[model samples]
Target: MGVAWPFADRNEGFREGLELALDEINRQGVLGSRIRLIEKDDKSSVTDGLTIAQAFANNSELTAVIGHRSSAVAVPASKVYDHAGLLLLAPSSTAPGLTAAGVDRVFRLIPDDTQIGSTMAAYAHAKRFNNVAIFYANDEYGRGLANAFEDEAKAVGMQTVDRLTDYKDLNDLRRIVAKWKLLGCDAVFVAEVMPDGAKFVSDLRKAGMKVPVIGGDGLDAAALADTAGGAAEDTVVASIFNPFAANEAVRHFVRSYEDKYNEAPRKWAAQGYDSLKLLAYALEQAGSREPSKLAEALKRTKSWQGASGPHSFDGSGDVRDMPIILKQVKDGAFQYLTEGARANE
Candidate 1:
């Protein structure tokens, strides 16, 4: 397992939830044999993930790997798994291009950022943010979403005033904010993860760029509201799970997670729980450890009653359907607003 462990609670939920799922799966006698899970820290870096993937691929006993929360890590590391004929499943990692045509070894349970970008663009247009600037992380996930939103922005009759990459440093972010401020953009779209996205917005506020800064799933965490403090107010993003869903299953998962962790579960925890459970079902169905057989078995999944939502994998290994819940930071917490969130309407 690979996650950004150093980063506060965002990815910590993933690690804890996955461990709990592994325990349950073992107790139920799934996987035909007692399994041992090894943990590795990718640090959410592409280079580190590549090294970790190479190590896992070289191990013959390793049937599959549950990893790589950041799409930046998944995109490059997946090639290693594909070449090694290992199944790489992720709980997060929503970049669309990772599962594009001809990529068979990688699969994700979350909706890709392509839909997120389009929905965000639509929200921007609906809110009349005609001229928006985009600042994205310099990685596969960020680049993929930046392009997706740029395309959708044009289709929705919105103009992308400027697009820049985060240099991942305070000085670079300060410079980027200055550039966007000078361009007179009505709003900014951030395509980075929790820490980076929140830091970007914090700097924007410090520099006095007060336009409604919207983000993707990266910013859709309670930690961001806490991390960005007052700067997170009015900030919006899309989410994968809905805590307010009245379904008993959803409620049960939430209750179990809260009981286990003493904190309300985030989408990361739900997806992490389902990813391993789904893999157990596929293993039982396949009755073999061969990567090819496991991949095929995973593909045949029409639906899995995920705690996040009902998920069906597409031919390209993306989810067939999942609602994107738009949320905003209010009083230092993430508050669910509506389904298919529009801009301030």
Candidate 2:
């Protein structure tokens, strides 16, 4: 197992989840062989991820690779894994292109950003926010999410006023706010990771823009509240799991996570746990460590209950029929709003 993250110090949730997963694998004896985890810090760089993935691929002992938290890194790192014929399971890389990257060994536990974008679009349409502006990171994850949201919003008769793409510089945000204001957008959607999303919201609010801001799962981290301060209050984000779901399974996972970590498990942690659990199921079913056989077993998974929800893959090797939750930020925290089923339904 290889745990990849952009910054070694920043991704505490992922680190914690990786620890829990390793302990669980040992405790449950899920794999017939003793599983060992190899941790790699991609430093949130695509080049670093690719290099580390190549190094892991060269190692014969590693049966599977478990993470590359950021989609930007995961997208390129996937090529390395594909060339090496190593199975890779991502806990939270939700970029859309991953499904069609022509990599048979790559799989993800969380629904792609496209799924979140569609859900947010439905929520926006339901609320009558017909004219919206979009601010997205100029990366694979952000671009993919923005595209999906735009398609769904258009399908529902919403008008896209402005689409601004940003990278690296914080000063570019002022220009985006001005553009959105000029377009007379009723609502604004931001597609970026927590750090970028926080800065975008903070900058938007500083510019005295008061439109309701919405975002994808990238803004689902607790750090967003700290980074955006009051700006994040009342902001809405869409994600795969709702901690407040009525299911007993979800409640149990929440309690277990809180008991273990003394804090609420973020969506990242939940996805990590779910990803490992899914892998364990496939390993048990396949009864072998062979990558091809394990991949086949993964495809056949059905009704497998996870911390997030019941997950099963579709023909594209993506989770099928998953439910998305629209969550609103209230009192500096993310609160559940409503649930939407997959678009195919």
Q: Provide the overall lDDT of each model, using Cα atoms, as 2-decimal numbers.
A: 0.78, 0.80
Residue-level lDDT tens digits of model 1 in 8-96: 42365776777767787888676557556777778777787788888888888788888887777887787888888888887787887
Error of 2 at 84 (Å): 1.2
Off by more than 4 A, model 2: 167-179, 339-345
Q: Which stretches of candidate 1 lie over 4 Å from their true place?
A: 1-10, 166-184, 339-345
Location of the lowest summed lDDT over 10 successive residues in candidate 2: 336-345
* lDDT for 48 (candidate 2): 84
Clashes of 1: 0
Best candidate, lDDT-wise? 2
Q: For candidate 2, lDDT tens digit of each residue in 13-132?
A: 666665676677778686556567778788888788888999999999877888787888888888788788888887777887777866787787788877888888988998899789
Model 1 is weakest, by summed lDDT over 10 consecutive residues, at 1-10
